[model samples]
Target: MSEQFHAFQTEGEGTGSLVKRTVEDLPQGEVLIKVHYSGVNYKDGLALHKKAKIAKDYPMIPGIDLAGTVEHSDSPDFSKGQQVICTSYDLGTAHDGGYSQYARVPAAWVVSLPDNLSLKESMIIGTAGFTAALSIHRLEQNGLTPEDKPILVTGASGGVGSMAVDMLSGRGYHVTASTGRLEEEAYLKKLGAEEVVGREDVTPEKIRPLDKQKWAAAVDPTGGKVLAAILSNVKQHGSVAVSGLTAGVEVPTTVMPFILRGVDLLGIDSAYCPMPLRKEVWSRCAGSLKPRHMEETATEISLNGLQQALNDILESKIRGRVIVNLQK
Candidate 1:
């Protein structure tokens, strides 16, 4: 049965114009999903605006995370009507993504919807929340804990940063949220950040190799100079989980922090993480790392609302998450 769906497509030259299309038009994949919800992320916003080199092709659907039900599957592992979540692995970039009523994704990229999450809640967490959980997991595995010292989260107003604050704080770590939005100080504290500091608090005076150690661990979504500053301030033997280049990609710092202080720069790539580990991380997100205000951290929108959301995210005017309700 052919079904028409609304999608935000990035046509040539990085323009996102809404297009109404049918399921039959989607690329062939082992699984066909009826998308229930999707989430707006900075990358998705970039895709919408044709920035960040995220979309590999024009006329691409630009949502990196989706939650829905399996309509059909060539693979024996999944059945029709089974709920599922799909994110990353070329989605919304190399392939048509979740910004539609239906999506066809490779079976390899699909994850069974965990019981603790509904389709809507899954998208609420989306790729941003997943990245946050993975960062925390890696940091803990690297010997970080609440006792290590106060953990700092940069870009604390964004999705990944906000989720990281919630997760780290829930795990008993004292969280310092760094953001330029002083207006959200109470909001950050509501999300469990023990302290809310200005973005300038972490900005470095010089491109130093190392500085006075401050945090025991850090979760950084803003890369570039912010990441450099975070690395410089992390205590000896501390770890910093690095994700995203929202600020910029160039990290202008020396290896003094890494070599002398034994600082670990952990890179988080959620797209191609191993399936087993990915599932494990999802399980953690559904349980221990689940943000108490998962819904509070998100604002729900319809497909018609995406363009404005994209604009807000790109302008850094948005705080917390934005989930797209396809059914709306």
Candidate 2:
């Protein structure tokens, strides 16, 4: 019998289809992982649904987050049977990624799984969780603290936003979650949001360079108008850490907030983050920054269910994180 495994590959541009793949078909790498879990992110949704051109290569496998054990290794630093995680750094884009049952990744892109996090738990906290943790890390490094006034988390129902809410709130920060889906108010509160506001509350009818001071800081993933509004309302010397552009990239605002309020707009780039900082952030995610409501913040789906889950995420129907169980 042929030694084969299942993978979802895109032949051209649109949605990829599942097919059998042999080990030889994988990209060159030092470590080959028998992937146990992966996660669906917003970028995965856009790429899979053809809403955005995310994959740099046509025959791409679109899963930016993977966690499993090393089945084989050519690097002296890694040994077979060692658990690891590979995320970002071109995975699922310029390089083949974790959508398959097996993934061959450069040893440099892999991190030994933190002792406290399980494979399934790691995928639940995948890229989205990591982005959230990095955002908070940067903000705190810029002087944000739990004693400050409420921190507004935009797009609170989505994965990054939800994780931000949970993690920030877990650390004793006063969290005010804002979402277009007002019906999820109960859900956001459950994730530790002290307050839940409607999207319209955050996106004003007309944005000013500065507005009434509302939040001490903000974790904004939606970007665009929501970011513009948050910038206007952040208190003096506060910061806004932005990670995603789901609401579009344009920010139509002046520099009054930066000049007068001294607000810092910190950009978070989870992909290609220096390995040292990346490992530090991952360690924090497995430690102090880990979401207390993690189990409530994620749902598991099989590889076969990815197509629909991708569409749901793009349509803003997914709440929290969605993990892919390769064994299923």
Candidate 3:
């Protein structure tokens, strides 16, 4: 007989319900993880709300990231009792995911938890922080540096944006955090943003191919008009690493920014990132890219708390990250 655990599942459009099941119900995989913590992401919210195409199947667990200890493994690279973190690679969407107390996942999807982070702290960083680090890595690889100029972090009140703001500021770069939540100005400052401005402050009424070059680089987790505005205003040789499409997916912009100013727009997809580079990024995140007050940036919830947390995230009423402590 196998042990059973509680998991949140999406049964159909606009419906999410919790279900109890045995470990044997999970899909076949080489490693079995006793999931300690899982984080809520925008995609998780979408899965819960049935607003996006995040779930490929009905009755699916919807946590994209998890940190845990290995209970069993057939793969030589991983062994019992080892702490590990798993993100992306279809953990939540196409397959049973980490929302449950236990998750069975492929060994190839696992990364050894770095020494600098605890299981709880790993969930604090989660998918959002990982994406922020990846954005920074892509920007740096494209020749961005602190000395270039101020880097703008759009949607700075949210998870990815907040992490980007903290990481960029920690690296001694001038960070301008843009957010619609002006009431959170002090919070943004505490995250190391040198300047905090409203969303409209960066967005102009008119759309131009290029405008005054205000930012040398930008980390945009919000798409739609905010992204369009950034592309029009970025400085010469500047780069924008775009991740989320929270505002909207369609981007209406002109080529003048790229053609006239030598600007570059880099896309960051933390999911399905190659293994070697993913490991490297996670290692760096556990090191220098680790955000200050990581714990402060996250609020922990339990399986029972997931319903309301999911609602809060979908409505954009939640701040920072929300971690679900399965064991709690």
lDDT per residue (tens digit) for residues 123-225 in model 2: 9999999999999999999999999979999999999999999999889999999999999999999999999999999998999889999999999998998
lDDT of each: 0.89, 0.91, 0.89
Candidate 1's C-alpha lDDT? 0.89
Write the residue-wise lDDT of candidate 1 on 154-181 in tens digits: 9999999999998888989999999989
Residue 51, candidate 1: alpha-carbon lDDT: 53
Worst 10 residues of 2 by lDDT: 45-54
Better of 2 and 3 by lDDT: 2
TM per candidate: 0.97, 0.98, 0.98
Off by over 4 Å in 2: 49-51
* Segments of candidate 1 deviating more than 4 angstroms: 12-14, 49-51
* Ranking, lDDT, top scorer first: 2, 3, 1
